[model samples]
Target: MSLDFVNTYSQLINLSADADPSTFYSTEDYRKLQTLGPSLPTLSYPFPSAEANLVGESTIDVKLKSIRPPFKFTTELKAIPGSLSIYKLKNQLIDEVVSLKEAGICASNLKFMIKSKILTDTTTIGLLGDEVSITVMITQPSHNDTSKLLSDPEPELEAPKSISKGAWDKIESVLSADLGPEAAKIAVSKFKQVSI
Candidate 1:
């Protein structure tokens, strides 16, 4: 027979509401299973070996270069299965990098590039090469995204100034010919008329 436990101890409804929302009980349960802490006592299993599931596919050494804010690091060669997609690789990286996991960086926020060519999530490991350097830019994460804002955006009090105004003033402005006699003057006269 399945055991059905009922709340017997009398507790005020207001007490639960004040502590957290209705989902608090469920969320707290999952918190113990979160792999980030790998949640203590519930140790996470080691990542699968890179050699798994190889048929004709070849493995590659990926050198991750975190180039953007929130986190930046030297290129580190990480091992992975050739069949792993950029999508899966991102999650794998998150699992491996403490800073990335702490920052709550997700796959969508990561922009990957190689030789100036942008890489999509569908991109696979073996397709890159036996060795490759992939640059990453993080969009930033906040509680699974706890990174806080250092400051607010500066408010603009005035419209942006344009530099093209002087060049567009064809009546003897900077764009007009001056020192060289060969080039005709656009305005024909440099003299300024004083207003009375």
Candidate 2:
């Protein structure tokens, strides 16, 4: 039969039409109708819909870059699903890119940001967009984490530490600075929003 591939919607297919056990095998059966061969009858299939979906979720490309640091990395993570959590992306970075552990950065210490906004662990890649480019920053470990690396851990003092009254007064004065007459008003409004 003749291949009516003249239509804009169709092209000559090489693999199985059913798409089961998905694979490609260039056997003599598909030596091409162009070259001398027995022509198979063209079976017209329905036009592919614009939303002809995949069996699973589609993947997005993630581009991560660290502009400055002791640990600098630039890489494109391909075909990653948007549903992937920020935590998983960090692990992927460690696995695929730099030696993060050697740079004193664990997955927990990694920060993913889009411009000024930071991403939480629960944030998914898909929430960003079809493709995401983010800035990666490595944070220094917390005081508790730093203590663990010491050969001898310091013993806790019986009394809690207290700031000097003069220092406290100086800090309060700085907060009450007169950048303008309305500076204190603005600072108070901002401080009200802070949880602590």
Q: List the residue pairs that clash in candidate 1.
A: 35-38, 142-145, 142-146, 143-146
In the range 125-180, model 1's lDDT, one tens digit per residue, is 88888887888888865443123333554576874454243443554444345644
lDDT (C-alpha, whole model) for all candidates? 0.64, 0.72
Each candidate: RMSD:
20.3, 20.6
Off by more than 4 A, model 1:
1-56, 75-77, 142-196
Error of 1 at 23 (Å): 61
Runs of candidate 2 with Cα error greater than 4 angstroms are 1-54, 142-196
Worst 10 residues of 1 by lDDT: 1-10
lDDT of 1: 0.64
TM-score against native, each model: 0.43, 0.44
The global Cα lDDT (0 to 1) of model 2 is 0.72
